[model samples]
Target: MVSITFLGTGGGRFATIYQTRSTGGMLIEDRGRIHLDPGPGALTNMARLNMDPGFTDAVLISHCHPDHYSDAEVLIEGMTRGGINTRGLLAGSVSTIDGIDGIRPAISDYHRQLPSRVLSMRAGDEADIAGMRTRFTPTRHTDASGVGAVFETSAGTVSYMGDTAPREEVTASHEGCRVLILNVTRPFGARLRCHLCSEDVPAIVERLRPELTVLTHMGVKMVEQGPEEQALRLERMTGSRIVAARDMMRLDIGDSLRVNAPTLL
Candidate 1:
């Protein structure tokens, strides 16, 4: 079985700064523990939930944005057991691995050396990690090198949209995925460039028609407007099972997907 835990669901500058919701990102447990986008509060959130970072077998950063890679180095340290031993994989986009103009590389050279192997990924790149085949999907964002991901796991295929605008390529890339997670950062009618809004969900859901759709990475506007209501609206429009992600929410995926109610930790 493949299990996923949402450590944080909030996004945007204000939301991340004030921490209206946690920004620690998600954890995927399959052949091994995989940490995705360990942003601010990642370590704290993991500790609060009694999740040991030492067990992580890989770290993935989707972009060079602070909200996506701020705590990555620290998580790498944990994965490598304080850098005492070189271990695990670190995979991400070109900007994340080598940085773009005016943007510092997310993972430092020292942290990059700690990983057993570091892969500089681009759209359409595929790599095997922890027995699963992962494919990088393109993203249209401020970080031009940003990419989304699709993981073919033992249980099923899981797709993450990362921080991107809704594009036809994304729909094509994520087709046939069992679970689809999107970073919807704004509410309907409030479309923003380089970021997804609630208005974009229905089309993507309709195009992909995944078994389940999870709405996460909510900004302050989306949060105040109510993610649940937005989800319900999208479900009605697309006829797909939709749910809003919350901190500490757990999902177990096998023949079917099961979501556990959020619990305070």
Candidate 2:
């Protein structure tokens, strides 16, 4: 079975600052544990849940945005046992790993050396991560080099659509996945450049028609308007199972996908 635990659900500048929802990212447990896009509350939330960062086999950052990579260095320290051991894989976009344009790298050089292997990923790149076949997918975001990912797990394919605007390539890259995770940072009628809005979901869902579509990484407006209500409206329009993920919610994928409600700490 493949299990995914959502550590945080909030995104955007204000939402992260105010913490309308947590910004810890998600944890995937399959062949090995992977913490994806660990942001501000990632380490704290992991401690709250008694999840040892030392067990994390890999840490993946989709982009260089602080909301996506803030806690990465600290987590790398944990993964390497306070830098006492060189273990685990560290993967991120070119922008996140090497700094594209004028943007600075998210991880420091010291932290970079801690991971046994550091992969600078680009769209269409394929890698074996934590015993799963992973593909880097393209994204139309402010960070030109930013990428999403598709993981071929034992149960099925799980795709993470990183902070991206609705684009044909984005949909095409994630086709046929059993579970689709979207970083929806805007509410209905509040679309913005480089981010997914509630209004943009129907068409994407119609095209891919995955078994489950998860809405997460909500902005302040989305949080105020309510993610659940937006998800419900999108589900009606798309005729698919669309869930608005809450911080700490878990999804177990096996013969069937089971959503375990969040238990706030």
Candidate 3:
């Protein structure tokens, strides 16, 4: 079964440091373990949680922002076993691969030349990774990781809305998604500049009516109301499963998916 785990749950400048809180991205393990968005706290957070960064069979960088692709070089080294080989696939924006202001060359030439493949994609392009199809859905956010990802799994389609505000085009692509991971960086009614806030989710929820809507990539300010509570309110408001994304949390894909964390089982 294909399973996904969030390595870091918070996003933006402030990373959770109190104990085990994380930021920005996650680890997806299907036939292989793929690391998505190695943000500021990704490596260290994975280490703390005993999830090895070296085991990532593939790496998907959503963009070139520091909070997203900052650790790409480090994680790439680990994934290739200190540059021994690049057995994993690397997928992201062209800037993240070819060359962007200072973000280019995140992966070494030797590793890039390895068995792995790198595809630079814009909006509406579909790429295949480990039997699952991924489409780069355009977002308003500008960064090295230009577009968000839509994962088409064996069970169903899941949309990873990377740092997008309320956009009809973005939500349009999310229609019929079984799982939707929205980057609700702020609490309800608190309007964020570009990131999504809690209150803004109902529209997407009501429109898409996804079977499961997971809220993640929170900012420090969102910590005040607590993500779990926000998730509960969101569930009541949207009539959908509002999951509070947390580090090491896993979900299995099947006829019906089940959410389980490392500590839970």
Candidate 4:
């Protein structure tokens, strides 16, 4: 079975600063453990869930933004047993791994050496990550080289639409996935540049029609407006199964998807 854990769901600068919700990112447990994003509070939340970072098989960062990469190096440290061994994969966007457009690399050179393999991934690049067929998908975020990812897991295809505005190519890349995790930073009528808003998600959900569409990475406004209510509106608009991910909420995917009760911090 494949299981997904939402470590933290808050996003955007203000939200991250005030921390209305945690920004720990998501964790996927299938054949192996893969941590995506690893933003602030990732380690702390993992401890809350009784997860050992040393067992993580890979770390996937989508962009250079702090909300997406802050805890990555430390996680790499844990994955490598405090750098005593090179044991895991570190895959990230060009900007996140190699730096681009003045944005510095997220994983330091010292930390980069800790992972058994380091991939500076771009959109369309594919690799074997902890037994999953992983593909780097494109994003139209402020970080020009930012990328999302799609994982072909044993249970089904899981796609993460990283920080991006609603775009045709973005939707096309995530098509035919059983699960689509969107970084919905704004609520309805509160659109922002390079970020997905509530209004922009309906068409994407309608077109792809995944078994589940998870709304996460909410900003202050979206959180204040009530993510659950926003999700309900989107579900009504698209006739799709949509959920607003809470911190520590777990989803088990086997023959079907099941949302488990969240474990609070």
Candidate 5:
């Protein structure tokens, strides 16, 4: 069965200190493993969890933010077996792919040449990777062009909200998605800018009404507040099964995602 692995559940730079958990993001393993948003501790966390980067077929970045795209180039090298070939797909936002002020061309020439195909998109653009379909969905945050990705996998459709405040169009992009992964950085009570609070989850759940709603990209505040309890609250309010993600957690496709732990390291 197809499965999604939560490599990291924290968000922002502070996530490093909150290393009791990880903030790297998710991995979708179907016909091939697809890593999304390889943040600060992604590769390391994967190793800790006993998952291999060389097994990946593609890496998708939502934006150029350090917490979202930092380790991509390094991960790419692993995927290509130390730059021996350019076979896997590399998809990222425009800013993430092309450097701005010489910052984001993060990967070297040898690495960029490894992807069999590379797609640089800002949002509202779709590309087919092998058999999986990916669409760059729009968001309200500022990131050169502000983009996120919606993956139409063989199992089901998923919309990963990289970073953004609630926007009218964000949910519509994945109108009938079965899984929606949102970067919920705040707890049930706090109010913030360009980030989502637990209170905002029900609206998304009611609107998109995905089979399962995943709360990710959390922060220390949320961690201290206890994401698990807040997820339970969100479920109570939305009447949808809501899950607060943990680093290295795995889930299979469908309304109820079965959990699997990486092999003990």
Candidate 6:
């Protein structure tokens, strides 16, 4: 079985600065634990939720933005037992692996040395990590080197649209995923460059038609407008199963995805 846990759901500058929502990303549990993004408060959030960073087998960073990769190195240390054991895979984009266009590399040389394998990926690239096939997908973002990710796991194909503006390539790349996670940072009609707004969800959902669509990485405006209401709006517009991600929200994916709210579960 495959399960996903959202450690944080906040996105954009203001939300991250004030922490209107947490920036720590999501955790995927299957054959092993895989931490995605590990942004600010990742370790703290994980600790609060009783998640052990030391057991993480892989860390996937989609970009170099502080809100996405700030806590990566610390997690790397946890995964490697404070450098005692050099084990775990670190996969990320060119900008994240090697500084690009003046954006500093997110992972330092010291941390890079600790991971058993460090994969510098680009759009169309694919990597096989512990039996799961991960394919890099294109993105339109300020960080030109940023890319989305799709994982073909035992349960099904899980796609993360990283931080990107709505693009045909993004939709097409995530076509076969059973679970699609999008970083929808704004409410409908509040379009922003390089980030998704609720207005863009319907088309993307229609194009990909994933069994489950999760909206996450919400900005201040999205939070103020109510992510759940926005999700319902998107569902009505696209006839797709849509849910707004909340911190620590978990979902078990099998033939069908089952959402397990922390309070309820």
Q: What is every candidate's alpha-carbon RMSD to the true fold?
A: 0.9, 0.7, 2.7, 0.7, 2.1, 1.4
Summarize candidate 1's per-residue lDDT along 123-174 as a digit string, tens digits: 9999997668999999999999999999999988999989998889877889
Over the stretch 43-114, how does candidate 6's per-residue lDDT look in tens digits?
998888887899999999999898999999999999999989989999999999998989888999999999
Clashing pairs in 5: 8-22, 86-114
TM-score, structure 5 vs. true? 0.92
Cα distance off (Å), candidate 4, residue 131: 0.9
Across 135-213, the per-residue lDDT of candidate 5 in tens digits comes to 8888877565658777787778877877888877886776888888889988977867887888788888899988888
lDDT of 4 by residue, 121-214 (tens): 9999999998899998889989989898999999999999999988999999998999999999999988899999999998899889899999
C-alpha positional error of residue 42 in candidate 4 after TM-score superposition, expressed in Å: 0.2
lDDT value, residue 145 of candidate 6: 87
Q: What is the TM-score of each predicted model, taking all chains together?
A: 0.98, 0.99, 0.89, 0.99, 0.92, 0.97
Cα lDDT of model 3 by residue, 44-127, tens digit: 767767777667777887776666777777787787778787567788776677767665655566656653677777788997
- TM-score-best of 2 and 3: 2
Backbone clashes, each candidate: 0, 0, 7, 0, 2, 0
User: Which residue runs of candidate 6 sit more than 4 Å off their true CA positions?
Assistant: 263-265
- Model 2's alpha-carbon lDDT is 0.94
CA lDDT for candidate 5: 0.79
Which of 1 and 2 is ahead in TM-score?
A: 2
Off by over 4 Å in 5: 17-20, 100-103, 254-256, 261-265
* Residue-wise C-alpha lDDT for candidate 2, range 1-265, written one tens digit per residue: 9999999999989999988889999999999999999999999999988899999999999999999999999999999999999999999999989999999999999999999999999999999898889999999999999999999999999999999999998989999999999999998988888899998898899999999999999999999998999999999888899999999999999999999998775
